[model samples]
Target: MAQNSYRRPAALLAYEVSWEDLDGAETEVSPPKLVEQVDVPATDQLELMNALWDAVTFDAPWVPETSEPLRLVGHEGAKSTHYELVLVGPSVAGGSSPIMTDPRFAGEHDAWDDIALDKSVDLFLDQILVPLVEVYGLGNMAQLDAARLSKMRERVRLIYDKHLMGLGVYLKAGPTGYVQGMKFVLQEMVENSAYRLDMANMIRDALGESAQNKVSIDALEARLTARASATAILAVVQAVLVGTDVGKVMYDLSASWPEVAWSAVSAPALFALSPSEGVVTRDESSVKFTVLPKGATSGNYRYRWTTTGDYGLLSDLLLPDAKVLDTREREVWYFHNSPANIQDTDRDNVSVEVFEVPEGATSIPAGAKPIARMAALVRGDTRVIDPRLEVNSGATPADMYDSGETYPCVEMLLRFPRDPKAYGYVVSIVGMGGVGDPRNPNYHFRTGNGNVDYRMDNKIGVNVSDYRGTCAWYNGFFGGDPADWPATEPDEIMGSGGYDASNETMLLMLFSAVDYDDDEDLGAEADLWKEWARGATFEVFPLYPEDAR
Candidate 1:
């Protein structure tokens, strides 16, 4: 059991545009832009790259992709050519803040690859502007100095702004996913002193001639979401795309949030790089399931334990895969190999990889068909799953905001079995029905989804909001009860959503929230997905109606 590290984007393809082409007007500057692409070395920006990768994979909370109100915005082929690249946003060339307009019209090659965190600044200095010096007949310089640096900064500042200057030219808007890629850049730039906002400058620019007058609430309020505001935010994005210090983009944008003109400030909680359908694959030797230890501290830790699904002489055999309810520090099991695929229970009856079926038996051992599984397109994380009922823990109701509750929880992605040959069963709901989720029950809860806290029988003493700022998500049973939720009742934890027939079995993702109060059942999430995948492993002795009493 080795630590699961985050993977960075394998490469970067940079595209530069001429000053004329970028601005949408004619200019004499030739060789003004050349696509000087380079592969970003993973080691260069380990932290930044991992974070960005997390965002794209949906493992991170903020960076999410949105589908807008489906409508065509004329033809984009005429605007973006192979040689040209545009910095897209809400209102491209429209009035006011073109940079913040809309991004619907942007073609594939139109975006500037500002994906480089601090490395972007280097790209600007070394590749973008440096090449221009020799080509423009400008005097060649040996090294960069204070004066030269300032000049270069100023020179490219305009170029960068114009890159996204007025792309809002065809701003067709949407409800969310508006600020599509800004969050990744923000996540990387936030802590660094380099990417800071200049509030004083923004104030000066906004007040204009009225700067001398005592600042009035009206003035501040007006500028909050006005064109100038968008300008300031986009300016920061431009600067950061070039490696400038944290600019006023995020700060300015926050003041006017829920109305930032475009883009979702946050995305639903999901495993970074997780698939949208919750589809997963697990054979015997190597399992490729992905889990996000929601509340666990950030670190490189190993997942060590045997899964009952591995065909072992262990307890909890009824479970397709159940990690021995264990923890670290005290006597623990194996810290052996890198986290890989789960052992396939289906094959156990015939030929298996990690686990073996007994001889003379055409199918699995008695009282077992295969592990029951369900498909799900589950997302979001839960915070602290307080194992204790501390008076203060329940003091705070619950911060069931959009995706914030997913913080500090565990993410498990598993498959629900659907094979009539091995075991026939349907996954259904229990506990908190659609009336509402115990944590954040609302009419919108079932707008397009359903979940049940099957093993949530101990609801009497548990507070809605645990000791932590958030409440435990009782939407699943991976962290189900052992005494109350006996191993026999896999059906008790089955989801209400039936197995999808058109496609193969889908994944059953369980984000079992962890508790700051205890660590005994800490390793549950890892253990669950590692073992479960067979269609009907867990079953009632009389699985087939009158087969047993």
Candidate 2:
């Protein structure tokens, strides 16, 4: 099958606050802030002209319409007008980063024609551009020499074309979609380097030497910085919306798993070993589904190869051999060898059923260890299903030390080799169910009015001390006493109520830890679960990091 390519946005609308009427007076807007009646090529204008000339050929639609208006009017019949102006482009919605955020294109016009592709492209462009300009605003032009300035303009042009134009397509497509857009942006940067430099210098000169009260260069710097940060945030948000390639990689790997190589047999009858459910079968291949019963609440379950393959697939892409067994009843059992090409004597119709295995009998092979272990108990797999990071409202808990606003949590998954003697994987559950204090219930710990009294100073308690040259922050002795802590192990460090490892997953979440009252924190728990599911997908194989090997 041909790989899915990036989709473009249909309409890119740039909004320029043309003019605003405050009370009864009119005001003008300036560069980076223009105030005037904004204009598009105009649908009616374009259509009437096109129809007259039979020039309309493409399905390109006009940009979206807005009630906000090109010019803002004061209440009733205000004699004066104040305006903020903007320019938007059709491709801005789905175009590359620079085009998306290009100051020149104000996306205010409505679409004359409806093209679904155009809409997507518009959305893509809109999602990305607004932020880029906000964040990287034509940085310091004073330092640019003539040649370098020229180069910078070229760079800007390249950014406009590639990153901006390619907005509609997926970012993961890499150089394919946005690469060209990036090039365009660089071209724009090169073409307009001198202009942008002159503009910046003029603004600096004007603002820097302004009277004590006028907008100062310092103020502009602050404002520009804020804008840049906002732009960066928007870019990050759009990248996330475009979706990551990680899940796709997981699904593809799962489809090629070894289980498909083995003939599909009737679901085996599970025997109770140590009062645990255990089902056995004579089949093996790339991917294997061992449905361990998650107790009685979940009915006769099926842990088959998942179409999405979000979890419960072998880690190593390589094939493995052996009989298939179901562990529905949480029992353990030894693998029973089958005669080569043997058929069962019983003539009864074979049906797939829950395989429960007693825990003791199904001990993992001590001598022949697989690099990783994968499992998904239907009900027990609650961790796998609910609270997918993609759909969740809560991104991350709000940092309490700062304003009560929340930080977006980044999701990551990692797979590690299964250990026979020790628990190989550890998941840190934050917010709500795990770490949050229920009494206060602060999602990001923003105490409102009367809620102030219920607040706690800090969530986690820690003792800071120095050992030799290293500063050791101790939380607790989980699994053992504090004295038994593995001081030399760099991976293990103080976390939440105890020490935690620096495994790929752990490190990802740990770095995201922020201060918020448990009650205020919203997304950490979901983040933890989603991270685990992602980690599970990776664990489907015995794949190891390069350093580990």
TM-score of each: 0.20, 0.20
Local lDDT at 26 for model 2:
40
- Candidate 1: where is the Cα deviation over 4 Å? 1-215, 221-244, 247-382, 388-489, 492-549
Clashes of each: 56, 146
- How does residue 448 of candidate 2 score in lDDT? 31
Would you give me the overall lDDT of model 1? 0.26
Candidate 2 global CA lDDT score:
0.27
**Per-residue alpha-carbon lDDT of model 2 for 354-419, expressed as tens digits?**
322234544333343221122211101112322212211212222221433332222221212233
Where model 2 places Cα greater than 4 Å from the true spot, the runs are 1-299, 305-525, 528-549
lDDT of 2 at 411: 22
RMSD after CA superposition, every candidate: 23.1, 25.3
